[model samples]
Target: MTKEQQAQLSQQGVEALDKLLKETVENRVLPATYFGVTGPEGELYYSCAGEKVFGKPEAGQVDPETTVQLFSMTKFVTSLAALQLVEQGKIAVDDPSVIEKHLPELWAQSIITGWTDDGEPQLVPRKNPLTLRHLLTHTSGLGYAFLRPDVLERYEKKEGLKGFLEANIGVEGYVRPLLFEPGTHYAYGTGVDWAGILVMRLTGQTLDEYFHEHIFGPLGIGKEEITFLPTEQVKERLQSMAARTSATKGHIILHPGWRNVAKMTPEMIGLQSGGAGMVGTLRAYLKFLAGILKCQQPGGIISPQTFELVFSDQMPEGKQPRKDLADFLEFMGVTDKQQTEGKVTHSLGLCYLANGSDDGPLPGSARWSGVAKTHYFVDPKAGIAAICGTNIMEEVPTQFLEVYSKFQRTVYDNLVQSKL
Candidate 1:
C-alpha cells in the first residue's frame, strides 16, 4: 500500500477505536476494548482499552501491546500449525484413518452412530471418513459445552474432552465415541485440542513445545511478547484483563473445561490450549493474522495451493449442508458485511461468500469470534480486516457489529463522497 493510503487506513482505524471506546463506556459494548487492523506490511491501527472498570492502570493508559486472552482464536493458530505439518508432508488433510493409527482410541468406540449432541443432530455413520479437513473446519461432530450445555454435560460425564483426549493419546489411549458421525455437523468442541495432542503424539512434542518451536519462535512471539499471564503475572496485567471483560452472564464464562482435569494443570493450561489458551497484544496478533489474511488471499505465507488444501470445503462430494453458515472465515479477520444481509450463519468456516440463494447472504463475510467477545473480520471485496478483542462475554449483543458496520459505512461514504 502507498504511504498515503496507509495513512488513510491508520486514521480510520484510530477513529474507529475512539468510537468503539466511546460506545463501551456508555454501556453500549463492554468497559474495555482492544482492536486493530493490518495488512501484510503495516498496522493500520493498534489500540487498547479506553478506561478501567475493575481497577486503575498502574502506568499510563493501557497499551494495545498488552496481552488479551485469545479464546477460540487459538483455533486458527492450531490450524496454521497443522498446515505447516501438511507443508512438510507429515499429514494428509483427506485421511481420517490417520486417527485410527495415531488416535486409535477414537476408533475404539462404535464411532458415534447415533446422535444427542446439538452440534451433530444426525450422528450418521462416518461420511466418507472423517478427514483432517473435517476436523479443521469443525465438521468432525466433536461436541463442546459452549452452546449446548446438556450435550457437553454428557461428554463431561465421560470425564470431559481434555480427559477423553489425554486418556486416548496419553498412556491409556482410549478413544471416546463420536456424539455424531464424522462430517455430519458443525459443532465447536475440543476437536482441535485433539489435533494439538495429535501433533504432540506424532511429533513427540507437547502442544506447547510444538507451538514454541514451530510457530511462536519463527514468528518472533516470545514469553514477554505474547503472554497468557500465569497467576503471578495476572496481577501485572490484572487491571487490564479485568478492565477488558465484564462479569459472566447467564452461562459458563470461559468454559475452561480442563480446569479440573489433568490436561489443564496451571502450566498445561498455558501450554496445551493450542485450541483456546493464548494471550497477546493486538499488534502481535496482527502480525500472525496478517500473514493468514495474505495466505488466505494467497499472498503471505503458504502457497495458493496449500491454502486451497487447508481451507477448501471438505464435506463429502455429494454431502448436504452440515453447517448453517456458508464458509469458515478461517482467519480472514471480520467482514464489512456481517451485520448486513451477508452474515452467513451456516458456513464451512469463518467466512461468508455470497452464496447465491434466497436463503440470503449467510456466506459472504469472513468472520470469527473468540469464545469471548474477541471477534474478527476481513472482507476481501471490502478492502481491509478488523479485529476487536475484550475478555467480556455476554448473552445480549454488545452492539459491536452495530458500531463496526457503521464505521464501514462511514468510510465507504466518505470515500465515495470525495470521488463525487
Candidate 2:
C-alpha cells in the first residue's frame, strides 16, 4: 500500500475502534473502556469512551490517563523484572537452586495427589525440582484455591488460610500446596506471585522499589503512572469497576468486590502481589509494551537474545493446559479450539498464540489479560503492541469479547496487514 493509502487505513481503523468503544459503553457492556496501540517508537493510537463511574456523568470521563487495576497484567512486568536478574547472571531460567535458596517456601510445596475418604488432601513429594522457568511459564504446579476446588480449595479450607484477595498478609496468602507436580502440567496460579517474591529475595529490595529504579526508570515511565499502591490523587483518576447484570438488557452495576477493594487503604495491604497488585494508566502500560516491542531490535530494555526467549514457546510435550485453565480460556473466548486440545503454550511472560488467528493477532504473538477484562498483545512480527482496557469484574462478558476480538482484527487489518 502507498503511504497515503496506509494513512487512510489507519484513520479508518481509529474510527472503527472509537465506534466500538462508544457502542460498548452505550450498550452497557462495560462501564468504561479504552484501547491503545503502540509501535517501537511511541504510541500510535489511543481512545477511551464512557464515564469513570457508570450512571454518574459528573464523576469524570474515562480517558487514556485513567488508572485501572492491572490484575494479571502485572505478571508481564514481574516477569520482565525476573528476566533482568537472569540477564545480570543473578538467576537462571532453568536453575532450581536459586529459587530453592531464595524462596524456600515455594520449593517446599508438596503436590496434592488426591483427596482422602474424609475430604482431606493427600500430598506427595515432588520428584522434580522447581525452577524459575516453571514459575514464569505457570508450570510450577501452583494454583489459586478459588480456581481449583478439588485440591487447593480443600487444602486452603483445611489449613484455614485466607484467599489472596481476602488476606491482609501478602505473599503468605499465596503459599499453597501444588495442584500437580512441577513442570508436568500448566496451571494458571500464583507462580508469578512467587516469582515476584523471589525477585525481592534476590535483590533485597521491595518489589515497588525495585521496579521504580529498574523497570520504570529505564523506560521513562513516571512512578505516579504505575504502582502497586495508588495514591489518593491516582485513585481519583481510577475508573469505577462495574459488573454486567444483563448482557442482553444492557444493564450494569458497580462491582461490589471491586468497591471493597477500592476502599482499601494502601496500608491495609501488606505486600505487593506481583501477580495481581498493580494500578496504572493505559498510556503508561502502552509505553511498557512498546518497550517490549523495541526489545525485538538491538539494545532495548532487554537484550535481543533475551527478547527472543520471551516469545519462544516454553512448553514441552506432556505439559498442556490444565482443565481449570482450559475452562477459564473458554470463558474468555479468545482461545482457538485447538488451544484446549493441547496446542496452547506459554512464553516466558505471556500466552503464546502459535497459530495466528484469521481475525486477531498473528502467530508468535504473546498476549494476556487482567481480571477486569484488561487485555493486551505484543506482536513482534507485526512490530506493534495493543491494549483493550476496561474495569469490569464479570469474567469476560460476551459483548466485551466481541469488541475485543473486533478491535484486534481492526488493528491488524488496517495498521499491520495494509503495510504488508
- The prediction achieving the highest lDDT against the true structure is 2
How many clashing residue pairs are found in candidate 2? 0
- lDDT by residue (393-418, candidate 2, tens digit) is 76437777778878888887787443
lDDT score, residue 408, model 2?
85
lDDT score for residue 258 of model 2: 42
lDDT for every model?
0.52, 0.79
> Model 1: per-residue lDDT, tens digit, 1-420?
432343235355467557756666556355357667665445666666654333333454556555556667777667767777777788887776777777665545444443454545333344446656666766666655544455455544555444432322342322344555666655666667667666777888766567667766766666655543334443344323332224544322333332222122344443365566566555676666656555554434556566554334444332333332232222222333332342343333343344421212123445566655677665443335567666554445435545545544544333211121
Model 1, 85: alpha-carbon shift in Å? Answer: 1.0
TM-score of each: 0.73, 0.92
In model 1, which regions exceed 4 Å deviation? 1-13, 26-28, 52-61, 111-128, 158-176, 227-235, 238-271, 296-300, 309-323, 326-349, 352-365, 380-383, 407-420
| Model 1 accuracy (lDDT, Cα) | 0.52
Position 99, candidate 1: lDDT = 72
